[model samples]
Target: MSSQAPPIVDDEECRPQISFFQWPDYVVLALMLLVSAAIGIFFGIQARRQKASTDDILVGGRQMATFPMAMSLLASFMSAVTLLGNPAEMYNYGTQFVVIGVGYIMVSPVTAYVFMPVYHRLALTSAYEYLEMRFNKWVRLIGCVIFTLHMITYLPIVVYAPALALNQVTGLDTYAAVSIIFAVCIFYTSVGGIKAVIWTDTFQVLMMFAGMMAVVFKGTVDVGGADFVWQKTVESGRAEFFNMNTDPRERHSFWTMTVGGSFLWIATYAASQAQIQRFLTVPTEKQAVRAIWINCIGLVALLLVCCWGGLVMYANYFDCDPLISGKVKASDQLLPLFVMDTMGSLPGMPGLFTAGIFSGSLSTVSTGLSSLAAITLKDFLIGAFKMELKDSRQASLAKWISLIYGIICFGIVFLVAQIGGVLQAALSVNGMVGGPILGLFSLGILIPWVNWKGAFSGGIVGLVFVGWMGFGAQVEAALGNLSYPKKLLSVAGCNCTTGVLPAPPLPGSYPDIFPLYAVSYMWYAPIGWCITTLIGIAVSWMTKFNDPREMDKRLFSPVLIAIMDKLPLSWQEKVNWPLKPAKKEGCENSGFEFEAENEKVQKSEDENTHKF
Candidate 1:
């Protein structure tokens, strides 16, 4: 197989390069946009007819279907980066990253049992609201700020990545691609809210699956078969899975991928506003649990296909390395380049693949916009400023907020394109903040003794420590002082001219950076979690721990309550356990409290509502 095949190798033998992008391609791409926009318009009119409130905009009125919400959850987390980057990851580093799915499996139960119950009881619009209920306004404000920064940074990269893919395939300018796609995303998200985002995601995820499957199946067939692809990848030393090295500095080891990756995903699924909002769309805790596990199954499946796709790419280019051959300028560009080489001859197939990449970007960007609007409205305007407004006006403000964020993300896309190298570092740094946020939530829900002071202090310290480590590591890599040992690649069978090939695999050598800075990027979250938890516990004891009985039992996870119940009577008394004495109602929080918490919280919120 010639890896260097171009769209127009010879006019006589091959179709014109112009025919590579035919009318059918544009039609398929247009249908994807129209369908996404129509979903938003449909929901927008429905909401207006009912005079839907802010809650409806943020959480589908808490009446969403489980399967759509499940698809939405999966789509929100799997962005253009995952769609493009995962395969490249496998091609370069081997399949050790596939074990990350195991982490997803481990965290599903934790997200369901530990975090879902608390969020369901609180009936939160913003996940940060739990920070206020468990800690105080200061901690909540900090959390809201971190989330805002994280989303703003992340959303640009999400939109920019697929824009790059579009640029690679269609000769479209990056700016135009970002503008067109982001405009559609913002329109649907602003007008239709969470309902629009969820339905669009469901539609787009199917497109994502179809597009990726096309690439995998077609690429595999062209390369020979699944067995050939597998054998080639294994011969190339890329079929690795279990790497038991315990060294934190070793990238993609079994320990880092599972334990550290679990903490990272737990933070995402259990604490991030975007995902928690998805969980809240369901009506019951059981439905929410079911939705999360369904998301788990879908995520694992998507990851396996992506991993397989990487092996297929390797097989096609085993004798002729694309990067070294200068057929693709970057590793991320390899997938799109390969698509054009193999599938460009088949009209709408190329468009479907492009739409799939764009769909990944669209789903994530829309999700981020919706989450940003919800967090800004609930955490800042309502909670911090105490700006009470009528439900209708609140809904209107949320739409405006969503629109503003969409524009901001679009503008930032240009900046991201300018400093492309830093995107990976920015992503790593996002995890640094994520771990502390997860720690704060974990403390609030699982540890009754942690107080507001402890949470605030621990979060601040953890952020600083992780930030220091992440920045130092990124700087070293940029300076060519840090590098990971990748599986060997060759261009020995190339029929065309080639550039300098990468060095063959070398015995691993530790980077001479500080020991802590040498830790694998995968372990960043685990490090932050440890720092935050240890400091939180220490600070709480010094400040006199929170009284478990004084706090709402609804704030604690059922798992913690069960363990508290089994404690020795003396230990229970010493720790002020039993939370609050069970009434004749029979300690429902102690068992399985399915009902919404006392309506007093809602009553107070309603009383606080102000007319426009």
Candidate 2:
């Protein structure tokens, strides 16, 4: 087979070409940079003055308010994926992308009630620290390792999505755009700490909202109106917005999204270290719960706006398809094409959209970089190396780690080109690690008898199975054998006079037959979680290895304890707490007598409480 590029179809001839930005767009770019920098510097000064300890730097000294926390969560989750990819997804696949919001809405309660209390009670700096207290040091280490790997693979793509938008508008190369954006993000995150990240995220969220709203409003006006757009979309059969039936094979059925997909959102928002770390910034669990609700509402609103933007694109092009216009070869390029072509003559509009895209990208990248640094320093470095640092030294280490990870993430952005659609690629990569991580965390929280042996074995097995399933699906899809639907092209606009495009050659090593791709991406989380938890529990029960006494009482949910009580004594004994007599008088204080020669245990507790 020849390695030449595929021949362009006649319809592709009308595709809008993007040229270099003119003067007004440059002014907009300059203003955006200046504002972003100002936000960074202001936060940095505040962080330096207020932060005296590692906690202050990593989690805002555990004193953030609901609005800031909600905004940070919104910004972190939105990312360039939502800004750029959502519109693209909508343009390509209609309103199916909106299904993501369904899962997100249902998952918030899980974060507020189930996950928030455990992390707050423990006063954990990193979510993985819970694993250590609940199971063993090895379990914590595995969780950290998986989280780090996921972020490393995931963060670069976050950077790349916006860079694609900026590249289209400004004619800048992807690598250069990625570097500039990463630098700005690192500067803000390193200087301002979590406070800066949250406050800046709040601002960026506005930018993102404004940019999308601009596209929606102007695009609608230009296309005649909302009614016209709706009619056109319905006529085109792209208005099938709701799918109420249950179909495991269908990607965006209402049942799958609300049930199975909710698990994925819960895994990320509630259990993922990156998100949990954000919630830890709040002063009280009440504030954290409030923040979770705020985030949920905000996310739903944002998703509606995103879906609206998609409808705007379809409506604007109702009479003239961009594909028919030859403005772009792929549906993924439709949104950018619409902006550049329809609004090109209008000054600074392109720049605003581009800025919004970058805002989303930067928000996510900064959070990922900061979280990776904190996790690396606290979970892996301190635990594995048996090294301890004072508050001052730990804070310094965190700053430097953030800087280093920024560079590494910038490097990884190049590989994002290999992935097809931004949303699908992001979710696919996330699921491979997220499923196992969620399984491990569930094992720790809900199953008291999961010993280190079972936990470790279960985690590894879960990771391998999830990876195989996710990657196998990707391979099948690439080969066009998967049941997932491809974008349909209209034959009316085609020019058959040109020789039919030669069939793309098959890979030398192809699967003999396409396996049934019944499992939707949304179900990956629940399926993986079920597999891992069941395997862990069964294996632990068979081995009778975990000593319940070793498990921390605080980590077990009431439901978990009920299950533990029902197990046989031999199994229960292995994992149950041993009985002990109450401490007498000064004996509890004997261990720490160096501070005070013969203080009573109650006195010591009183003194310690008073000191704090």
Candidate 3:
């Protein structure tokens, strides 16, 4: 897995290897791996000292500061797929893509106020536990299945993208890149649990910034300056935005990026278990809100940087289009190519970029593997089968489960090529998983009438509908039967003396005949969400509704309780009066009680002590 200078081309026909990586890059990469593993080992000793209570191992005893938790959440969500894909998006489509950030205008409030209040009140190990409490076990089962599918599908892209970038730039073998990164990720995550994951994520997020900033500064300087890059991109028609198109078929209009993209955000940021798991890691609701703000603010800033990185790429390749000239096979390759070409002038900078790419990749896989294990153990094995292991045994089993998921994630990388491009593939799969969960959970919060049957039926429909529409269009795009508009490029000044000129461009194809299939991928989450909510409501009317008197108060929202309280006594019974938590005394306990398991381990194995 050690990095080595790749074999150079011997023939004249072979263009000179422009970015051959050297010894310093390998040294930097090794240091990054060592630091990550060391964090795990440090946490391992801490666990041994305290005999590692369940709370400490799983949720940092709910005592982590807001900063690293925020950093971990951001790194977990932003893959190298995003780090590289965003800039390529800016280069090819222009600046209109940045409007996707506007979706957060609603995202911050909705998650902090609506969703956080519920999850924060319930100190469950897995968010899917809410499903069983609100609806029934079957509904909980569906949520777990889709969430498992979503994470399983997503981590492969995280695994593959950085490997692809590093392989192209440093001539590092793709297999070695995947193997080395995941091995380090698995080692840290399996040994350290949640605390190690959070701290290492903080360190990796720093590396990600260092790597990206290195490319941005060097590339910007090489392209003259940020002002020149902007001027050239705008003049060349690569800078664009605010096209208020009403049609849903247009890929990235303000309407689609904001109106449609908001659904994508709410679904993932509010509804997905991967994120909720982080929210529960905090001790208090206030810190949870604080962490959410940090992630939202930090993400927009990073996106702006990646956007500028794209402009720098366009400026540097202004006349010598790498894709057009066949210097790279895909647009995703452009970033690594730019980094290698520009940073090759320095000794260790290329390694820094390589470490940065792997940083995002490793963080993503580590978080996914860790969270999936918790879900598998808590929601599936323990909740479903009533596995009654002692706390120490459960913690040990979690490590084994994490290792298994790491192995599965690595294997999936080989099959992920057919899943679509990096960014589109991730968002579409997330949307498909996220939409139904949002619908199911929204029903739990808003509609007390929805039972297990209704949620189950509605969720299945949302999953099928979103999957069919999203994946169908992705297939067409993959086959080249579907394509998006790209800003024109010219290679007139490439300085290539030998190879023949790029082939002429292909003509555009007709739009898909089915309007549903042609709708922007950004809209898939919204469409699936709407379909699920509507269908769930309709199904509730047709089937047996839950007797509200029999239900637990924690299943409903405080907003609903507030509205019911103001109603007159006559109207109150009509809407199911005496909901348990409506009483002043009972209402104070929002069911966020962390009920520690009674089963105990030997003192030597699990000395549960209050920690600093």
Candidate 4:
């Protein structure tokens, strides 16, 4: 961190403002939209030719290729919120935020080894089906309902972000742009299904990379070079690389990024229907595992590019902050403002950038719509109501369901537009429910003792606990009683006649509140996971624990089972694992009555043992 404030430097050539959103930009943007729609149409034709089944419509018939699957998984969650909000995060916070990439790295193995194997073996359309298998239908419905609500709240924010960018650079009506984007997404997603969503996502991910790299490349060159950008950022106290603080209330620390952040990613990859459906699209577990690693690599690369774009923005505005000078209305608009300032004059550059932002939103919404359809059909229509239908009818119903969800998402966009600081707001909302959802899945996989009663109780408690803290923090932030201080800003070279905005108050100056409310949003997932797991185990013990010998091994995580197999014989005996099969008493079944019914049709003990 530098001690000297940035000097007042009157430099005109360096701060040239150019009008963007011209004909060339429009052509480039229109090209992306057409290509995305075309992909959906092509896949729709292919599906019709083959007379695709519900499996084909929802999960690509469980035979999708690896590369596209990997890209779709990456694009689905890393939405415009990621592309537009992350650069702003870097600009407002600092490099300490980059440690979140490490969280992505940690998620790969956890998903591949733990969650993937269980889901792959089950081969269910809805990931929530595992909850029912482990507990009962009520648990599965709870998971489905949570996911539906999550996507409803989340998709609107994803769509609104790029619309905000267009409003900033092109003066486009935000809701109008959102409507157009959602219409295209709904058309392709409903027509082409998962195949169309995955292919379009692959194309959009390419656009994302191209657009982000173009900004980074042009911004670095325009700002004098990478070296100058680094120097300026360091001098302005914005090149923060390491903050080892362990305090939960301290935002963007190494501990929060790796530990708490890993929990966030784990919840996303392990439990979220959007990612799980993509994982099941591939032919085998190995391909899904490979795709997870590939997605991790791409994600890290994209994060680095977005982070560097922030540094480049800082370098260009080192002596004149845009927000302080009233050049940009919101932090989320800083990237678009920088794009227009630097690359606006270049033919198609601004359009290419806008296309990339829209691509992120498109991939996300399409995936959400597809996943929502699957959850509705598999978990609710079939699992809850026991509806039976032909494969073609099921596919038709799914498309209609997806169309309805798209419209619902469009309506939610108006609400999301009112929220500020998209990156944190998005993450905070995700963590509030995401933690408990992950905890529910984790309980089923790791704790054989947990019954339906315990699982349901723990999930409800975790959701309430995290929701209380997350919403309280948001209210405090809304009221301006709490905020993380941003990196220093300067308006020394402002050419406009606006008053300088005051620096944010330090964390110490924040109003007192419940300590839990002050905890960083990063910890929400871990906190939810812990509360659910502990309470679930305690409740199960107090009621009726599952008989280890009677429980199905496939429901347990392979990693846990493998570790137990290698444990000392005495330790295994103590846990009552690999024990002699006891004759079942008619009323002594696990509180999971679903499992009890399954016992009658289950395979022989030797067959089950051999399968494990």
The lDDT leader among the candidates is 4
Cα displacement (angstroms), candidate 3, residue 144, comes to 0.5
Clashes of each: 0, 12, 1, 0
For model 1 the local lDDT of residue 542 reads 98
Candidate with more favorable, higher lDDT: 2 or 4 = 4
What range of 10 consecutive residues in model 1 has the weakest lDDT sum?
1-10
TM-scores, all candidates, are 0.91, 0.85, 0.89, 0.91
Residue 71's lDDT within candidate 3 is 89
Please list the residue runs of candidate 4 whose C-alpha ends up more than 4 Å from where it truly belongs after superposition: 1-18, 497-509, 579-612
- Flag clash pairs in model 1: none
Candidate 2 per-residue lDDT over residues 415-459, each given as its tens digit: 766665777778767766777788888887776567667788888
Stretches off by above 4 angstroms in model 2 are 1-16, 241-247, 323-326, 486-518, 545-551, 558-612
For residues 1-612, write the lDDT of model 4, one tens digit per residue.
112333333445334243548899999999999999999899999989999999999999877888999999899888899888888888877888889998999999999999887777666678988887778878788889888998999999889899989988888888889988999999999999999999999999999999999999999998999999989878767776678777788877889988888999999999999999998887667778889999999989998999899888988987678765556668998999999988988989999999999999999999999999999998899878989888899999999999999999999899879877888888887888889999999999887768888888899899899999988888877776676677777665665423333555554443477788889999999999999888888888888887766666667788988888899999888877873332332123333223222343232423322210
TM-score, candidate 3, is: 0.89
Candidate 4 Cα RMSD (Å): 5.1
lDDT string for model 1 (1-612, tens) is 012222222223222122246789889999999999999999999999999988899999887878898999999978788888888888877898889888889779999998887887667888988787777789889899988988887888878778778888888887899899988999999999999999999999999999999999999999999999989988988877778888788867888888888988888898899999998887766677788899999999999988889889999888767766556666787788788888988989989998999899999999999999999998899888989888889899999999999988888777767544323444485579889989899888999988888998999999889989988887777677776765767766664433424554443457777888788888888888888888999999998988888667778898999998999999999998888732323232122222344552233333222211
lDDT of each: 0.82, 0.71, 0.78, 0.84
